[model samples]
Target chain A: MTAPARTTSAAMLDEIRFDAAGLVPVIAQQHDSGEILMMAWMNRDAVAETLATGRVCYWSRSRAALWRKGETSSQVQRLIELRLDCDGDTLLALVDQTGVACHTGRRSCFFRAARDGDWQVIAAVETPPDELYGDR
Target chain B: MTAPARTTSAAMLDEIRFDAAGLVPVIAQQHDSGEILMMAWMNRDAVAETLATGRVCYWSRSRAALWRKGETSSQVQRLIELRLDCDGDTLLALVDQTGVACHTGRRSCFFRAARDGDWQVIAAVETPPDELYGDR
Candidate 1:
């Protein structure tokens, strides 16, 4: 399924309120299961890239550059839908995630739960990062 | 329900990874319905306030101070639980919302649906903003 309206990229970009660091927070969710996979930051270019390519791309603060999800680990996320919150400061990307979404090789990055005043590991790693990354 | 184990505020706070601005992105969801109500930012103090008081509080980037949800519009969100994502950059707040959670008096701030390339409003205002805010 596609968006109902085909708006100009400029107009869509204009709606977003990027922070002083020129980044916006985005949540990646499993399209089929409605499970939240991870949260990351995206710059204008990363946003443009994901919309244009249908692949989830993010702005790596540490790398100071565009980072493509699953590029290194091969756990790619195929974009099924991209949604912007009402205020446009946040985004939710529904994706068909492959393998795992966490560096720890878990199904989701939110694999821990805060309960009883402590953090508990709710889910275990589905695939080890060693296997997903395979040497570098 | 209560957590299996109890922890301290300092321990919980230390696990969080606040951004350079000392803020974290928070998503408030309806505890029973699983519907997302709104997104907000929180500083360390706001985090403590919500946990200590069981009332959701956020940081107003514009006002540069603590903002208690529903303080003005009476759309209070009582904290059901607090969760931190694995990396600790994002927070999920399951809440018992008393009224509409949007400033526009909608049940949820995410009232729009992006479909078929267009933005379609899926939900309507539960209470009109005029009545909720009342000339404020």
Candidate 2:
């Protein structure tokens, strides 16, 4: 599908009911496959930049700044669509993900399944973690 | 698919990495169709309770208490499998959802899709808000 329309960041930003911390939770999913890649936080600026650039941006709680996905890992997520829930407190970004979405080198961050009364690693690491973050 | 193994709520709870507020974000999804329902927060007690009992429970930030899904609306979500992301900060609960998941009576809270530079309602409300929250 075509990417979400641009030129409406201001209108879109107004609809988001950001939390007291000025951040909102965002879920990123693989656009074509419908597979959820990861969950992250986005502030007003991050959301605006993503809509402005068609590239996913998030708020790094640790860095306290804008976080562009794949900035260091080269696992960029190109925004295909952006969605807001009924409450406007949450967002869903449909994106075209490159390589693995997990820092652990897994296709997605959700690789561990609760099974047999414990956590089980259900998915294998597609790429080595060292290779993904070798520069860092 | 069969439901996930139970009998280890304590062990499961230990793996969760809740935030400073003692809560973690949980995404609920339709297990059979792979459709995302909604996102909610869960505390340690809520997570344990969900595993102990097959029902999904959330930490209501507003109510400052346990919020059971469908407690009033009867749109329950039965846990099919729970997965933890690689970071242990977020969770994915695959569930067999009954009735509607959104308070607005939409099957999913993600009914609004960004299209043509604005939000578009893609999914119609399956049930009316009055009927869902009438008892309240």
Candidate 3:
């Protein structure tokens, strides 16, 4: 199936009704498999950069800077398509994910489930955390 | 099929790794229909209250207070099951939703699609926005 093309930065950014913090919640999903990989915060600048470069960029609330996905880790997310939810409050990013999307080297950040009152890992790490981050 | 039982509030809350803002993003999905409804923020207290009462409660970022689901709009979301993501940074609430979930009275907040480089409303509002938030 062919992916939908992204809109111009001007039109796309205008559609987003950013919060007072100038941020929106973004969900990264694997394009072909329909697997949700991770959720992160994205500021206006990050969203613009992602559209311009096709590399998913996020705002690290902790670091307070533009986070180019896989800048340090090799689990890059190549933007295939970008979507804005109806209210224009959240973003859905379809991407061609590299090795892994989780900091833990797992395929996704949503690998755990609260089952029977206990947390269980439903998915395993594709690469070791140490190798993916590599001291950063 | 019966719903999965919820864990004790004490045990479940301990598993959430709230961000520096003491907030976690919660995704509400229609239990039987599997329809993604809306996403909201939740604090520890809201999480505990929701679990204890079986009413999906959330923290209003704008109001900075507890937001009881359907407090005014009659769009209550009753908890069916709650899942904690692998990183413990996000939560998924399988809920039995009553009435509309979006402020716009659409069945979901994700009603927009970025089609052909333009934004389009993919889903129609089931109820008008005015009646949903009446006098509030």
Isolated chain B TM-score per model: 0.92, 0.93, 0.91
Give the per-residue lDDT of model 1 (tens digit) for B1-136. Answer: 1232234368888899998899998988788776667789999988888887788899998899999998888888888878788779899888899988888778877665545545567788789999988986
Query: Which stretches in model 1 have alpha-carbon errors above 4 Å?
Result: A1-8, B1-7, B112-120
State which candidate, 2 or 3, has the greater TM-score: 2
Encode model 3's per-residue lDDT on A10-105: one tens digit a residue.
Answer: 776888989888999987878887666888999998887887677899999889999999989867899987777766888878789998988887
Tell me the spans in candidate 3 whose CA falls farther than 4 Å from its real position.
A1-5, A31-34, A134-136, B1-5, B9-11, B19-21, B30-35, B63-65, B71-73, B96-99, B115-118, B130-136
> TM-score, chain A, per candidate?
0.91, 0.93, 0.91
Query: What is the alpha-carbon interface RMSD for each candidate?
Result: 2.8, 1.3, 2.7
lDDT of 1 by residue, A1-136 (tens): 2342223366667777898899998878787776677889999988777776778899998899999998898988888777777788887777899889989888877766666677778888899888998887
Candidate 2 C-alpha lDDT tens digits along B51-93: 8788898999999999989989999999998899988999999
**Docking category for candidate 2?**
medium
* DockQ ranking of the models: 2, 1, 3
TM-score of each: 0.86, 0.93, 0.77
The model with the greatest TM-score is: 2
Most DockQ-accurate candidate: 2
lDDT for each candidate structure = 0.80, 0.89, 0.81
- Candidate 3 residue A126 C-alpha distance from true site, Å: 2.8
Q: State, as a TM-score between 0 and 1, how close model 1 is to the true structure.
A: 0.86
